[model samples]
Target: MKAVKWFAPHDMRLVEVPKPAPKPHEALIRIESTGVCGSDMHYYTDGRIGKTIITEPLILGHEYAGIVESVGADANPALVGKRVAVEPGIPCLKCEHCLRGRYNVCTTLQFPGGPPYDGALAEYSAVHAAFCFPVPDAITAAEAAMIEPLAVALHTIELAHLMPGETVAILGLGPIGLLTAQVARLAGAGRILGTDLLGYRVDVAKRYGVDAAYNAQTIDSVETILRETNGRGVDLAIDCARSTLTPAIACRVARPAGRCILTGISGEEYGQFPVDIARRKELTITWCRRFRFNFQTAIDLVASGRIDVRSLITHSFPLEQSRDAFELVSRAGENVLKTSVDQ
Candidate 1:
C-alpha cells in the first residue's frame, strides 16, 4: 500500500508501506476521500498542535470516507461492501467517560493523524467497525468525508443551547466556522455575523450561511460585530478559527450573560483570554472537544439537503499530490475553502 507520511514541517512524501489488517473489532476500509482540515495544517506547517507533537513519520488524515472491503471476525459482517464515513477516534468502551456516553473524551481515545497511531491518508485504513456509518447513495464520497467537520459544527451549535431567533457571531470563517454558521441557522438563530482574516472566506461564508461578514484584517471585528448588534454584542459567540485571539474576541463580541463556545484549535499550549470581560459578564464558556454521538445527525442533515456540505469542497487532489493539497490549505491559496484527497 502507499501512504503520505509527514517527515517534517511542510514535508509529506508518498511512501510504500505495509497494508494493515483489521483487528478483531475493526474493518478494513479502502479510503475513497480524505478532507484536509485546518487542524491538520497545524501539524503540516509546525509538526504539532499544542502538546500533540509528531515525533515520527505519520499518515495524516482523519476526515475521510471509504468502502468497507472487509471486516474482522468480531466486526459486523453486514458492513462489507458498504460505502461509509469512518469516524477516526476509537475509545475504550470500558472507560468511565465511555460508560457515560461521553466517548469523545474517553481517557484512552486513540485518534489517528495525531501521532503514533497511523491515519487514513493512505490506500486503506482499519477503523473500528462501529465507527463506520454508511451513507446513502445520494451522498458522494467527498460529502461523506465532510461529515467529520460537519459533526464538529453540529456539536458547536448544540453547545450554544441557543433559543429560537437568538443572534450568533462566528469567529474565523474557515470551513468549520462557515459550517457552524449554517448549523446555527438551521437551529433557528436570528442573525449570523462572521469574521475572517481572509476576504475570500468572508465572501464564501455569506453564500454558505452568514447573514453579515467582514474581513477582520481591515476592520476591527469586535467593534464591527458590536456595532452590528447595536453595541449590545451578539447573543451567542462561537470561535472556530485558527487564531488564538478569537477566544478573547468571542468573549468581547458576546453579550453579557450569553454563551461562548471555543471550538477552534489555535495550536498553542496556553491561550490568553479576557478574564475581566468574562468575569463581569458572567459568561458561560464551553470548549468543544471533537464530537460525541453527532455523526448520525450530521448524516441526516446532509442527506436531507438541509445542509450544503458539497459546495464548500472547493478543491480536490490525488493521493500522490497530498503535499500540494496541504500547501494550498496552509497558504489559504487560490480562494481554497475545503479540500479533499481522493483516490
Candidate 2:
C-alpha cells in the first residue's frame, strides 16, 4: 500500500507500507478521496495541535471516503462494494458519553488523522465498519468526503441553537465557516454577516449564504457587525477563524444573552477572551468538539442540492501529489478553499 507520511514540519513523503487487514469488527476500504482540513495544516506545520503532538511520522487526513473492499468476519457484509463516507472517530461504546449518545466527546475516543492514529490518506484504510455510512450514487467520492465537514457545520448550528429570523455572524469565511453560513440560512437566520482575514474568502462568502461579508484585516469586524445590527449585536456568533482572537470577537459581536460557538482549531491549548464582556452580556459560550448525529443530514443536504459542497472544492490533486495538496491548502493562495487528494 502507498501512504503519505508526515515526518516533520513541512516534510511529507509517499512511502510504501503493508496493507492493513480488517479486524473482526472492521472493514478494509479502498480509499477514493481525502480532503485536507485546517486541523491537518497544524500538524503539517507544527506536528501538533495543543497537546496532541505528532512525535512520529503520521498520516493526516480524516475527511475521507471510499468503497468497502471487504469486511471482517464480524463486520456487515452488505458494506462490501458499497461507496461510503466513514466517520474517522471511533468512541468506546461503553463510555458514559457514548451511552448518553454524546459519543463525540467520549474521553477515550480514537480519531484517525490525530496523533497515534494513521488516517485514511492512503490507497487503503481499515476502519471500524460501524462508522461507515453508505451514500447514494448521486454524490461523488469527493462529495462524500465533504460530508465530514458538513457534519461539523451541522454540529456547530446545533450548538448555536439558532432560531428563525435570528441574526448570525461568522468570524471567518473558511470552508467550515462558509458551510455554517449555509446551514444557518437553511435554519432561517436573517442578515448573515461574515468576516475573514482573506479577501477572496470574504468575496465568496455571499455565494454560500452570507448576506454580507468583509475583510476583517482591513476593518474592525466587531464594530462593523455591531453597526450592521444598529448597535445591537448578532443573535448568534460563530468563530471559525485560525486566530484564537476570533472567539473573543464572536463574544463581542454577539447580542446580550446570545450564543457563541467556537469551532475553530487555533492550535493553541489555552485561549483568552474578554471575560468581563462575556460575563456582562450573559453570553452562552459553547465549544464544539466535532460532528455528532449529523452525517446523514449532511449527506442528505448535499445530495438534495440544498448545500453545494462542490463549490468549496476549488483544488484537487492525485494521490502522488499529496504533499502538493497540503502545501496548497496551507498557503490557501490563489483563491483556494478546499483541496481534495483523489486516487
lDDT of each: 0.94, 0.93
How do the residues 156-209 of candidate 2 rate in per-residue lDDT, one tens digit apiece? 999888889999999988899999999999988988999999999999999999
Q: What is the lDDT of residue 40 in candidate 2?
A: 94
Encode model 1's per-residue lDDT on 1-343: one tens digit a residue: 9999999999999999999999999999999999999999999999998888999999999999999999999999999999999887999999899999999999789998988788889999998999999999999999999999999999998888988999999999988998999899999999999999998888888887799999999999999999999999999999999978999999999999989999999999999999999999999999999899999999999999999999999999999999999999999999999999999
State residue 215's C-alpha deviation in candidate 2, in Å.
0.2
How many steric overlaps does candidate 1 have? 0
TM-score of each: 0.99, 0.99
Which residues of candidate 1, in runs, are more than 4 Å off?
none
lDDT of 2: 0.93
Total backbone collisions for each predicted model: 0, 0
On lDDT, the leading prediction is: 1
